[model samples]
Target: MASGCEKGEKVQVGKSDLEEKILETATELFAEHGYVKASVRDIAKLVKGSNSCLYVCFKNKDEILFRIITDVGSDLLNELNKVISKHDDPVECLQDMIFTQILFSIGAAKKMKIYLEEQYQLPPSLKEKALDQHRQLYDLYYNKICEIEKQGLLYQKIDKVVMTFGIFSNINWVYRWLNPIGRLSVEEVALQITDMLLRSVLKNSPLST
Candidate 1:
């Protein structure tokens, strides 16, 4: 909505609010038009702020994109940590993790889409930063699965790498076609997927020993 040339309307957006606005606009733009195609001026225009405001909040477009990716990653890790703290049983914790992943994927579908689909658009330096954070996320899930196996709670011996990838691949692909306005609410989709995944990995699963 922001044309590059119009003067930005002055508003009382605080530092945090302005940063959030820039990230939100960047996410939308990056989602609609790939990250390579979206411009800082476009984002500034949409937020009704000058490019200088964005610079105050972030160094550049890449930094904004990196922040979006890391922010979501941090939130996911925090939620996973909370679930782990609340649940002693590995199975319950894993179920909570699955549910949380789906719920977050639905809630931040646009951000997730940009993170997944436009990753290559970032410069090598920024791209590596994103990749490293992504690896950290994978490690979190992999370590959790390994913990369950170490506790002898696993239904069978499973490859932590394969299992982690399978779970993430199953859920992450939902971003490609998930409909937020479809018949099912986000909670319902999360629940359905959680049940499905738990059924596959639970100690008494039909598919397992």
Candidate 2:
């Protein structure tokens, strides 16, 4: 009798809450005192776990850093996919992407800071792989923008590469100054940014109106 198990299905095993706490502590430590300066002992101590426990979860500091980067990237890509899949209209898709990204940035500001500022501190091979992951993300935005243009929604013909870069620059860097405890909530800020970007690109959406 043939069972129902498939060959290519991916099984996602959830991590323990304690392990999640360890990663959270590590993110704070790395952000506070650069990735290279933050030691595994510091992370273990803050997580209230022994060095051996960290070793059980991660091989070394390098593995921890890679894991943090990989985890955040995976989440962002998954969310981006969801936003992309939900909308048939490219303009709405990009707006949702911007809003979702802002919410992600606000919620994971510390992790975002560490991911952006600490990439070079990773080992050479690891750094290369991490950067390649980043490039893949960039390509996603580029392709999305290109698809939008193909629909003739853009008012003018602009360079796709430069436009993609511009869009990322216009949105992603907000992590540097966004305040979670500030006057505006994450949803509010995301709405404003989404409006700003959508008005910039959509032919029917004007900035002044």
On lDDT, the leading prediction is: 1
lDDT of 1 by residue, 94-115 (tens): 8888888888887888888877
Q: What TM-score, over all chains together, does every model reach?
A: 0.84, 0.84
| Model 2 lDDT per residue over 59-140, tens place | 7898888878878877888889889889987777787888898888778888888777777778999888888888888987
lDDT of 1: 0.77
The residue ranges of model 1 lying beyond 4 angstroms of the native Cα positions read: 1-12, 155-157, 206-209
RMSD of 2: 8.3
State the C-alpha lDDT per candidate. Answer: 0.77, 0.76
Model 2: lDDT of residue 156: 75
